[model samples]
Target: MGKLLFYIFCFLAFNSCIELNNPPNIQGTWELLSATTIRNDSSIVQDLENKRMIKIINQHHFAFLNHDNNNGKDTTAHFVAGGGAYSLVGNQYKESLEYCNFRDWEGHNFTFSVFIKGDTLIQEGIEEIEELGIEQKIIEKYTRVKVGRKRNIYATPLM
Candidate 1:
């Protein structure tokens, strides 16, 4: 009886570390859930709130689509950055975006802590605001909707 109980305990412990929905390949494309921009005020709070959509082409590339429900205006911006990386641990994924020698923003690094469950991906990170040219971290959250099917970026161009 004691041996059986020990085995049960071990099984439960091992299974707890496994995520029910393993991280999806998530290599193709994804769309953003919201749109916000840093305010020019002292606090640098995000303002001009609007429902925004973003498409992540891959682990390295992404696009931001802005939507104004009040005015019915839509605009999209394509961005490509180098040295971005992603990793998965259990059900959690870590994504890093580096403004590596980019035009306006350089030497800027942003890290996100995310989790994948079922068909949803939730990411949370801190965005630093340069106040008086001083950097201060501000918390931000992002939800990405995985569309249709997961296609290999190498096989086809992400739309």
Candidate 2:
């Protein structure tokens, strides 16, 4: 039965090697941690900032509310959009918006790194904000909850 055992091993290896870019399981709540804006030449800007909350309902829909962290007011904004796709292949995730209705925003694409350890999740990426004409790299941490937690859910990456 040595040959049979080898065949089974090969089968399992093949299935395990299948990498999905932007896997669907990431469809949940992700809170923002920290962000830094960079110029085209990779220079850090002192005044640029961003704080956000991202919610992915499914493979084709997601919502986001981002605000300036400088004000410290913790303002809330809403975005409703459809026809978007996301996937996590290896350690990188690509989030794309086919059409979004958040003030002259459409076809926006962003890439970030995702790490999952136990129930904690972390996402980091350089997100493009066309309205501000700048790109910012953000590091976000999160913890999974049952959706009934009495917290704002988007308060901090993990609450």
Candidate 3:
């Protein structure tokens, strides 16, 4: 009985010291690094050279804003903002777009498969809107933004 008790104690101690691995948390601000859109048997890579976009995520919601880095001076300067509630289960993420500058995109739900490696996140999904005649596969990569760092050169309050 004494030997058995000693062995059981050793096993319990060993197990207590072993840590269980958990999935990385996805809550934070992420900056768009690259985006690729595919449709109609053609693929196009978005031009992000003169623009900055960032997505902010919290417990249950996410918001994104994109604008030209030229402070709206360029002829093609434009801005887009949208946000909504999101649900994340494992790597499956679903966004319920409640508000968007584009009225047609409001109330739409988009689902994407997300993967995070270190500080980088990659999202891939298909966006289809029959009424809008839009169907495309989008792959976007983002880098997590660190706190206290300037999000972009054309900084606004949204950052």
Candidate 4:
């Protein structure tokens, strides 16, 4: 019985030394609350009054969709969508965009500093595309979507 006790103690000691490096639990549906873009000579706050945007994040992949909330009634109606793989190390989040409706933005990687406070998530990062002549710092805020007993109309069907 002495040898069995020694083996058990050793197993417990080794298991205690092992650290599980699990990333933050960000897998869910999030809605964009606000977005601000800063350029060299201008800073613009995106007009979200008539727009709706949501992001869906899983274990290793993420997708986003944005469109006019009015169902394309206005002349300025727009729609955009993209999705790809992402990695998160602590507060540093990197997204590898593989598919986008805007072809020019595909295959680009964007790194952001992410902070989550309760139900709100804020991401700040610089976006630069040489071919597009765009270099801007963007800060985006999102709120986690809570699904209640009834089905949420905003929840998109995940394939």
Clash statistics: count for each candidate:
1, 6, 0, 0
| Tens digit per residue, CA lDDT, model 4, 52-151 | 8889999999999999877988886899999999999877889999999999999999999887777777889998889999899999888788876222
Local error of candidate 1 at 9, Å?
1.4
Among these predictions, the greatest TM-score belongs to 3
Residue-level lDDT of model 3, residues 51-113, one tens digit each, is 999999999999999998899997969899999999987678899999999989998999998
Task: Please list the Cα RMSD from the true structure of every candidate, rounded to 1 decimal place.
Answer: 8.6, 6.4, 7.4, 8.1
Please identify which of the two predictions, 2 or 3, would achieve the higher TM-score against the true structure. 3
Question: Mind sharing the TM-score for model 1?
Answer: 0.49
- Judge candidate 4 at residue 10 and give its lDDT: 97
lDDT of 3 at 59: 96
Q: Give the number of the best model, judged by lDDT.
A: 3
If both were scored by TM-score, which would come out higher, candidate 1 or candidate 2?
A: 2
Please give, for residues 28-138, the per-residue lDDT of candidate 2 as tens digits: 665444334455657452222244344544555555555454455555333344436776667777777665656455677888887775555777788787676766676
CA lDDT scores, all candidates in order: 0.45, 0.58, 0.84, 0.83
If scored against the real structure, what TM-score would every candidate get? Answer: 0.49, 0.52, 0.80, 0.78
